[model samples]
Target chain A: MRYPVAPPTLADVAERAGVSRQTVSNAINNPDLLRADTLARVQEAIEELGYSPNRAARNLRTRSSHLIGLKFQPAQEGTANAAMDRFVHSLVETAGGAGYHILLFAVGEDEDHLRGYDDLLRATAVDAFIVTDTYLGNPQAAWLRQRRAPFVSFGRPWDDDAADHPWVDVDGAAGVDLATTHLLDRGHQRIAWIGWHKDSRIGEDRRSGWTRAMHGRNLSTTGLASRTEDTVSSGHDAAAVLLDEAQPSAFVCASDTLAMGVLHTLRDRGLTPGHDVSVIGFDDSQVAQVINPGLTSVRQPLEEVAVEIVRALEGLLSTPAVVSPGVLLTPTLAVRETG
Target chain B: MRYPVAPPTLADVAERAGVSRQTVSNAINNPDLLRADTLARVQEAIEELGYSPNRAARNLRTRSSHLIGLKFQPAQEGTANAAMDRFVHSLVETAGGAGYHILLFAVGEDEDHLRGYDDLLRATAVDAFIVTDTYLGNPQAAWLRQRRAPFVSFGRPWDDDAADHPWVDVDGAAGVDLATTHLLDRGHQRIAWIGWHKDSRIGEDRRSGWTRAMHGRNLSTTGLASRTEDTVSSGHDAAAVLLDEAQPSAFVCASDTLAMGVLHTLRDRGLTPGHDVSVIGFDDSQVAQVINPGLTSVRQPLEEVAVEIVRALEGLLSTPAVVSPGVLLTPTLAVRETG
Candidate 1:
């Protein structure tokens, strides 16, 4: 009787190489482990029969692709500010240390990019995901939870229902409190807040913190000033409006970028930063150092937040369904000549 | 006699949802194609049966992962300048437009870090790889070639043996030629070159271009000056040495970051840039504008190069391997007050 022949497998190569199947697998995966002679024999056999180890077959036994996905929602195209650039750098360093590679996907213009999220999950392209630049009532987080896909958010979630999801967020409220309290302590009563969109969670949190601090000092929050956009031009325009309508002793900005704009506006109007009016900002970005008077701002621990996000993902992977949902990192006040 | 039962499959879900088996599969993989009612019914059935679609079974039939890897190698940690940041932004935009995602990986300092490359290959985490910051005699390239993995490099390789590999690189040599020729046209007889280590392919290419340009104009190529590190501090130190030893009418630097250092040194000596001496730099980074005399430099087409690299990878996947191995992109010289 004639019998059909089957292709050679790792077992056949292992027997031929005088090694165990696990050793052969390891030799293929991590060649540095085995002796040179053993590796050579296995390689020779693999070449002789044109045998390619099927990666899909192995991945079936192990339900991981050893890959993680990072979703970035930028404020605008062709514009990566210093804060976002540093965050991306930190993500790469922190994720690489955890033995997981990162896949970057951008949500451009389309606010409802949950279809991309579904494609990644259904295709099993990654073991977990990291989402950043979150907005109010983000649908992406809801979709991930519905599918039971593991993910971590870099910003605070707007919806209270999604608060149980894993996230590593900078303390925006505390940062605002630090800036506001500092101005109040310096005997500045009529303080103005600049650079924020009212709908944003971060903007709301920061405004609340400022209002609480002001109310604690027997001041009213109704007349507090704020701006819509955080650009340098916006800061100049906002400064114009503030100076024309209400003369505040100090101005608190949402970002250093905006503070730089305010500083320029102040300079054009013959006003010094620390002498004429005290100015404070957030993020303490590169603009802080380059701008004159050296901005006094809040410093967010970007590296620590990155590390915590990686740890959160690892925790989700190890326990499957058990994970602490949130981590709030503290922000420090960086005092300079501005305040 | 009792009959044995088989596991529930897509057909079972289709029957329960009153849809075709293909429709059920489509609802699982591509939900956009199915009606909301049909997708909801199919998904409910899938959840009730506690069934998970076998990814191995699907990938075996398809032979596609829909993922690509992008390897980013910075010169060192904390050295991601504006050019690098722009490169990453463009890479993401171009890759995402082609319906492919980028899996980003960085090379660490460990000698055994090459294992990360092997793991990426063995696990099939990506369909093709895009390598950046390639140096001479890189082990990563050799291993990828040995494994028949499809890849493209961002810079020229060290060894001519691997000349057949695909690469998309900025023409540093052409940039140097442009700078040198610009200075020569400005009637500068004695010109100095400030660059990085000679061992680097980029540094060597720039140096060769400078030498050839000088020789073309019948100028002396002796006393060619360079520094080991191309940073601001290094540029400052190198400029001091050049000023003391052989003072040239013009100075060509490797990068704007380094040019800032040179400018600082010249300023401290009470020498103006545009009037006393002319300076040209590569990479029109942010510092170029912040400096007193705006730097005349070669502005590399970072976004265009990134777009081309993604297009090359996509072409490699779609067509047969008949295309050329490498592509060189030209840089444009931005004329400013310094030059």
Candidate 2:
């Protein structure tokens, strides 16, 4: 693919600076080892010739890809999780600024997720991976640990028992605590909680906060909980079931998606949301603002989450000897209309 | 980082098969030059030892990457275009199946997009780029042409000019025509058009279809059009303004997002959407099925569009001589409850 005129290479830069090729490499990769004057001369020559190091050649030389792989399961229709989208944007921007590129691979429904991870690693397409979803017996994490591959999870392990790898996650319990406290402060005595029905550790963490808050306030938690999938329609159905059992003055939801369903159900029943049943949601995603009354939800610190995840991965790549500690960022409540 | 026991390389394979290293390389890269028995023997040997060719090594040797870069400008919160998300998924899937990886870079709001393109090209980080969005005076396209870099766009060039590169796009005019005819067949007499209020070639193409169909039917186009940004709130505002001037029995929208706004407005005004004012939208994304009344929309053939774009890029790379022709795929109308 070379044109009539080839690009200036390390050798060309070295020749222009009247130095050896190793000098140019050090000036670029390990500048501290070189003297100030020598580094400046090499840097000037490199810039004057627009000498960009070929990533492929560098990968071959160092046996490391300046690429990070992020296997994303795109958000679905009902929730349209804009928060995840923003998180990804932040990850890309932060990684790129540090001279790394993100290789995006779509995880298909009926595909072998672990095999994809293995292929990307074996092919040297990525140096490290950022895994966002960690479920019970996640094969991707298992395989990565087996291969001693460099990888970090964006969420905590399914249980603390497997917190053997690097991870960064938003504190779900703290997030719900903020929302629950806000609702309690508004004088809503009978506050219920809505969450995903699946046995997710993240969901349970969020529920624990409500349980703790309610218990500490000498309030009963009986007949005040409903579980459904994190979707608007599911939330609506959960609300119907909850309302049939008891009358709660407020509801704390697991996601903005579920909150939307509750909002729809309330609107359909000709009930004013904040007055009849104040509701709050977690993951103050973009959908929170779009809906009428602007759902009062807990805002995940996505920028910090992404930045710390990248920093964790960087630490993992640089060390490769010790396990990095997990980072837990507290989510804050973004109060608007509903609650 | 080769392990203690290195897997069989070409030299090892050649030694075992009593052939030259050149023969092994040909067997892997271009097996047509090898005899049937020799090719089968090499393939069997490769599988027996699980010898996967290292991609980074091959990239340095051939000066080509099995990587295609796509700089995506994520859809905004107002519209949060799910259609584009589906398109991206399709692109990643098709590209992955063909042994190509997608390097995703989030195109920042203030960053120079052309500079990103130029950097990726100069760094040899990608073999080619897939340009999905093209507008007037698109600097990215111009720079690629000037640099003789390989690229294929997913949309047609702006202003019908700058058709110097390969592209594959769905026929917008035909898409709206299908929707208009579907509505007309259902006996809708007064159908109005709503689309993004920008000088976009794609928007104009869709509007022309509605205009042509109405003119051909001897219907007056007066007071039957309104424009807004591609968002639900914008759609709602547009409807509020248009209702003061004329009351159309049906609204043909440019996107599913706009259809949502119309539905919301109808719901707020205590009017049943499908019964009071029929609505149709374009880009039958996931949101179409999730809403109260499903939206009848024109679905862009995303899978075909992605596949064709990849094929066009492949053609461009292999030939590297002529501009590959733009492939225009026809979009189909998905009939749902709204219309």
Q: Find the candidate with the highest TM-score and give its number.
A: 2
Model 2 stretches astray by more than 4 angstroms? A1-53, A160-162, A319-323, B1-54, B160-162, B285-287, B319-323, B334-337
Deviation (Å) of B268 in candidate 2: 4.6
Best by DockQ: 2
Report the lDDT tens digits of candidate 2 across residue range A1-339. Answer: 322123467898999998999999999899999999999999999876667788788777766667888876666765735565667778878887777788878767897777677778667678788988887667677767655577889888775464577888899998898888888888888888998765877888899999988887999999999877887788888888887788888999998778878877887788888878898988766556554566788888988988887787777666334456888999999887789
Worst 10 residues of 1 chain B by lDDT: B1-10
Best by lDDT: 2
How much does each candidate deviate at the interface, measured as C-alpha RMSD after superposition? 10.9, 5.2
The DockQ-based CAPRI class assigned to model 2 is acceptable
Clashing pairs in 1: none
Per-residue lDDT of candidate 2, residues B37-143 (tens digit): 99888877666544567777878887777788888665565453656566777887888887778887765679776777867877888878898778766767776
In model 1 chain A, which range of ten residues has the least summed lDDT?
A72-81
